[model samples]
Target chain A: MEPLTLDEKIRILTESARYDVSCSSSGSSRSNRKGGIGNAAASGICHSWSADGRCVSLLKILLTNHCIYDCAYCLNRRSNDIRRVALTPDEVAELTINFYRRNYIEGLFLSTGVVRTPDYTMELLIETVRKLREEHRFNGYIHLKLVPGADPLLVERAGRLVDRVSINLELPTRESLALLAPDKSREAILLPMRQVSGLITARRDEGRRAPPFVPAGQSTQVIIGASPESDLRIMTISEQLYQRMGLKRVYYSAYVPVTGDTRLPALNSLPLLLREHRLYQADWLLRFYGFTAYELLEADAPNLDPELDPKTGWALRHRQLFPVEVNRAEYEVLLRVPGIGVRSAKRIVRSRRVQRLRLEELARLGVVMKRARYFLTADGMTSGEADLSSERLKALLLPEKKKRSGPEQLSLFPTNDSDLSALTGEL
Target chain B: MAIWRYDGSFTGFLTLCAALLSQGEEPEEIISAEPLQNDLFRTIISVASDENRGEKMLAAIASRISPDSCRLLWQAFLSEAPGVELLLWRYLSFGRTTGVKCDRFLAHPAVGPVHRLANSVGQEAHRLMGIIRFQETAGGQWYALVEPAYQVLELIAPHFAARCSDMNWLIHDRRRSLAVAWNKQEWRLTRFDAQGVPPLSADEKAWSTIWRGYFAAIAIPERANLRLQQQHLPHRFRKYLTELEKPPRR
Candidate 1:
């Protein structure tokens, strides 16, 4: 294969990388300077704090776009007509170091399709990362993709070198795997994820502080709408992954139908971006917002409300829980408030230790009072005539027209709570 | 109204804050000026900066606001944000009556400006954190240059210290004319002339070879949203970036 120009490789790998949603870079010890190695700031990476509170944002990319597998939802599927390019191990390493040098990227997010075999592809990724860390002494954020069905030793060695590792589950169930992605199976992906998670767990318990294996931790991506699964089913699988398997993130990518396979749904062209978005919101509630999957997808609300966010919808449905006292609400009660995020709730709890806060004080503590005001009572004052019935509360909260007419920001992944500009611009 | 004035610099501001604590007065008035030439006929007690008084005052005011202000206030002031000084003073005064506060200022319209400024500081720190490209140095160390809008030297250094804990690294911010260097397990901030930044590693060819290769390998072509990429990773930032190695088209 001919070597790709910088423009060509960027086109290929960035497109390939787009399907993965983990780009948070926070919580690490930061000390970016005037002119040193790396800046963990606007110059290098603008971090989006993830659900687990870990921050990551390497130059997330894949080594090649030439995939042998025909994952029906992916553009890189072998059946799809796309210009194919692959970077050599040296090319991958060189590009990462170059990106690292210019302060364009914090680290390398290197994933690749199976060029020949799982081992061959895995070996290339391992060597590329090894060369960067050992030969180039590139001590920065490196998240290597764990190819499903790669050698166990290769997977283990990858864990040792990179800051994080991800083996995407692509779809939820084996049935969906069989239907949409003929080349992929749940076993191939979950086996490696379970392996990496087990190793990460083992190293943590050693207590010797062995260079934290996957310090930023393991994450996976699941393409939404490719299979016939409900939000309940999708979240149920994600909940198990978080609790039973101990994964860092389970990215939900709205299926952008690039392939026309008879096995997949025709509606995939529009994909379920909103559904994927809602799932991410529900996922945030599950992880950091302390929501359970069953609770998020209640009996009446089987799927998320595409119009209102899951949290907002939950607040509307559970009107009986309105006007929870903010100054003295339990952490659980505080978490239930829409717009009062995990960070904001923690801030409210911590700040109360100083003084009994007023409704105005809630805003000062980072609460989006515009949304939270309808749901909470701060210092015995609520945003209502003490008599506005639950019906009126819903009307006040709903308003005849929506606040803004754009699609809701990603409420699902990392339950993204940054300025909406970060979501609409980056994604 | 006691206006405690100091030289127009962070150190000078801290120096005055330290002096204000000595009078045991909640200096309702704080101002930053570069030795304003005014011969006042009225009584103005020239507050002498006692050594211990200065350190204690500096700690008292700084400890109450945010370590982030050490990196943000100057930019906030430079932006000429209304009431930043007053808000910082207000925050300090109230923070004196505090327990785990600072996030509280996020919604305060008065302190809102400062909180917004801190958000920018965090944004800058994280942008540099992600965008900072590291070039390999001849001495087996990683080197990169940054040009943040503000003096964020103290804001983002520890990230590298923790991730690349063993290696020696430096991020030189050309805009602020400052640098953060991590060597022997410690990070130090120092001033440098931005105009005189030495050329990147006199012989820089071999260092970025592997890096350039890594950059070339990872991009997915079928999904090229250059408009979107340009929005977050703009073209103006390409000069020092290795992945964005080639000069962007005008």
Candidate 2:
């Protein structure tokens, strides 16, 4: 009701931010000292790219946590029992300035509720960021939350100011949106995300002479497990986001329910952290690992194998593709093997010039031997062990991995991996 | 075998590498005799402070040997090993007649001993880069305390000047008893054996608060690989910071 105090605002904003997956990187948690002002060493690592391209960390916090809508999966949703607070533009700016001056953080992460109206709340956020940048001359990195349903004018203005803007697509599907989060619509979220994406594209095409709009680009969050979509659908949703939406990152936050709503699935209250971790891995595969969502999923096979990573699982299912000769394999073929990353592929390419590249050379270049050995023939040698069958290899490779950790957890294709893939009503 | 002593500098070592690698009666006897005993058990020859001869020697090695091969000798010389001058002499002598290329030494049986010596120098160079903690001085000059493993003060000065371009910084490696100073535009090295550094007034409390909050906030418990985190940012380095003091996550 009343504008909350600074502490109350921090509590509300930070609690509300808990459901938002992007900020897990401020740092790990730590115990507070009796007289200390803040804690930087606890249990996390928030790294940032310094002006010199060094990834450093800065305190990441929200200005307020109170929300207007009743998002089923959000901790800051209207009905959650959380303390509420809101720091003034000056207070937020000062805290950031104080922390930055002391090298406490790389920058600030400011998010807010749709307080009263979307534009009104967005303005409060912009004012805080504007004052911080213009008046205070705070030049470190800043990640601003571009509130969904906010005015396009406000979203564009905010996009031009912040390093990164994230408009969360809280639920994966429109049907799920109606069933679980009744207030939020598909267009309401996509419109703002599209606006920000377009703004970034326009600025880039114009060759922005000055600082770029959203230099780090736009990222969105999807609350996994809150809806009824499978992993295949989830990854498809992710694929379209990257290919069509032109999003930089689509963060998957496993649904952790805060309120008991019969309509909402009961299992989602705890952070589906493992699933979230898996989705991030899968997302990386699509973006950097050169993996396609179609390759990651089959028509009827719905989920990623929880036992092995998507890449490893892919290799296992397609055993006929094994023993790729490292000395002669193309970069594309090298990428198909389970354990070789981009760096290793480059290293493999580099080493081939200097030497004929025996099995020992790949190990020297940092290829994980346990997984890679089955898939690669170093020099001219494949496995001397003929008994190294696909099933036997999986048994040996993942002896401790008798249980799989994620299939749905890894939303391989953000826009297409889940329900959106099914209804690609467009595709 | 013979030893050729140096004035403890990389260029001086490069000079030594050049002279030994030259083809004549074979200077396979190069080694150091700087009050330290020679491991190679070679004849010791302390070349006089003749800049011209040193330059001539370096130029010769750079010419006869591959520029890359000469560079490896230069690395060995900077290591300040008692017999690097001798080993480079041996390697060069071997290269002259037998064609022992530089790449061979990188994975050579004899290169292990040479690398162990060269690594001592490189480790210091890397340590000075990371562990040389800087402090804001009263006179606007930033003072850093560095306890490097080797005599790497001369090696790291130019880097500081370029990285902290606007500031005048002084890095004093107390153990090596030398210091590097940057005067905004250029860097200069000097001998500095200050008895003890003034106690650093790092805002331990403020840094701790910030570090704790930072460490806690960044780690995704779902993704907190303690083993991986420890590997990247070790536990030993955590004691001085704000965050590592916290207990492990259960």
Candidate 3:
């Protein structure tokens, strides 16, 4: 085959790499050095959003599509005869610089399928990042992926170079991993995660002398729907990743079937976008809203409610927590209200410090009265239909389904992703 | 009742505030003295822009109320929304008594409009920081065009300045006829004219083609949600986005 041009390499690599959904460029405050070309914004910037509604924060592409392990659910599996290509370290660095120059991307997100061995793939990724940072003097945000079984030494070196690093814990359970991705072991995945976590903490303790170790911290992805693990299991894993591993984020990607394998789920099972969306909501509740996996779901009730959000679902289940008095409730209690978010909760606490919050005032402060009015009281007054039964309230709170008509009208103010907008605090 | 008119500058509005507060006269209306906005019934007092008086009023707000309140007022002023001057005046007046915690009084009628205006301007500025796209010129200068709802060039210039400190760039606000020019060191806001597409670099076409291709290739076809895409990148913004532009025929 003729050598692929840079354009061809970019298209193929980006197509293969889009499924690994961890595209955040936030959390790092790396500033531009003398003669450096860029800096990292503490709140990540999205240059453009793709058609799937995902923010294109970084230039996400693979270093190589060549692989040894054939993960059954993966697009780049060795068994699949897809077009294969690889870019040199210099080529990747030049692409990043040119894209950054045109304001097309914030930085580079470099991931790869194992080229020869885990060690070789790790070396390829680290070299591309090092060339971008050291040779090109690029101070932009870079998120590098750690090959699952790569040597710990290379992982440490990668941790020190990039702004953020990650390794995808592809499945939630050991049985699922064994059945689907037999080449990847549970220990091999967690090793780099634990090592990077320890290094980040130890470096923080070592202070200014040790330099920064993944200043944006580490994150990982867990594929949903491919395996039989329930939403509860996914939330439990994410919670552990946050608390135990000290991971900044745990992304949940809904399984998009690419290859046919006997072990894989049926082809008719469409991508579980709604389930993935609920997991994202539950993940936010765990990280910011002071909720636990146990509180969100029980072993029997493993799946998140398809019709309602995780917060509203929890609020309905725990009826005793309703009618939270906004004027007198604690900040944590206020956060549990169905419609209130982190920002509105803080605003309620702040505004109440000056004066008692009334029902009208809560709306002005950005409280979603549609859902919150059923869950809270303001200034000793309950809103309309506040005393209704849980079933009735759930019926009222369920989002009114839009009729799919001749042509979908684009709303000037989109409410479809209000829950998501609140999570990212973007748009 | 009397209506106050200013020369349509932030300092001019501040001077109007200084004049009204000194005289203890209630303002029935505060409008900009541009495009001939006038009233036949009320007495019109045209206030001129005074640098010293404006600075003094700014210092007073910072010291008496809060520096954040000053920032809020400036951002609201940049919005160019109708009746924002009166809203700022009312907010400042309320802040005098409420003190530094005036901003936290979100429920107060006087404070809410100013807060919303400032918040809108700030949000638009942040959004434009990401939406603005640059293409390299033949002379190695990077150029972009923006037509934001608010005059956000001054608000967003510093961000690009810090990120692209080593490169020369120009971000032109075609709607406001203003631009920010950075020459590898400092940036300055200057008047700019709308012209046709400038001569681009030789490699610009290929890079942009790849960008558009990458954009198209990155979206998951199974999860194509045009509603969500329109939510983030609205139709208004697609006009200048290079990725959304149609490629030339072979």
The lDDT leader among the candidates is: 3
Q: For residues A6-39, could you state the per-residue lDDT of candidate 2 as single tens digits?
A: 4445544544554455542222122223322222
Model 2 TM-score?
Answer: 0.73
What order do candidates take by TM-score, descending?
A: 3, 1, 2
Which residues of candidate 1, in runs, are more than 4 Å off?
A: A1-10, A25-44, A47-56, A81-84, A267-271, A385-392, A399-427, B24-28, B34-53, B56-123, B131-149, B154-250
Candidate 3 positional error at B105, Å:
0.7
Q: Per-residue lDDT tens digits of candidate 1, residues A1-427?
A: 5775665666567667655766654322223333333323222344222221222356667788888788777778887887787777787777666555545456667888777878888999999988876776666667788888899999999988877788888888888888777787788888888888889789978886456577767888887777777899889999999998887678887665566677777663222655766777788789888888888786665778766778887887787877799888899899999879877888778767655778877876778877788888988988676456766666666625745564333223333254432442122
Chain B TM-scores across candidates: 0.70, 0.68, 0.96
TM-score of each candidate?
0.78, 0.73, 0.96
**Superposed Cα deviation of residue B218, candidate 1 (Å):** 8.5
Top model number, DockQ: 3
lDDT by residue for model 2 (B100-199), tens? 2444433233443564466557544643343344555446556766555566776667544544555567877676778788876678888888875454
Off by over 4 Å in 3: A208-210, A267-271, A405-427, B35-38
Q: Put down candidate 3 lDDT per residue, B162-215, tens digits, no spaces.
A: 999988999999988899999987999999996866799999999999888899
Candidate with maximal TM-score: 3
User: What digit string (tens of lDDT, one per residue) describes model 3 on residues A266-373?
Assistant: 743333666777788788899999999999999999999978888899889988867888999999999999888887898888889898989999988889888898
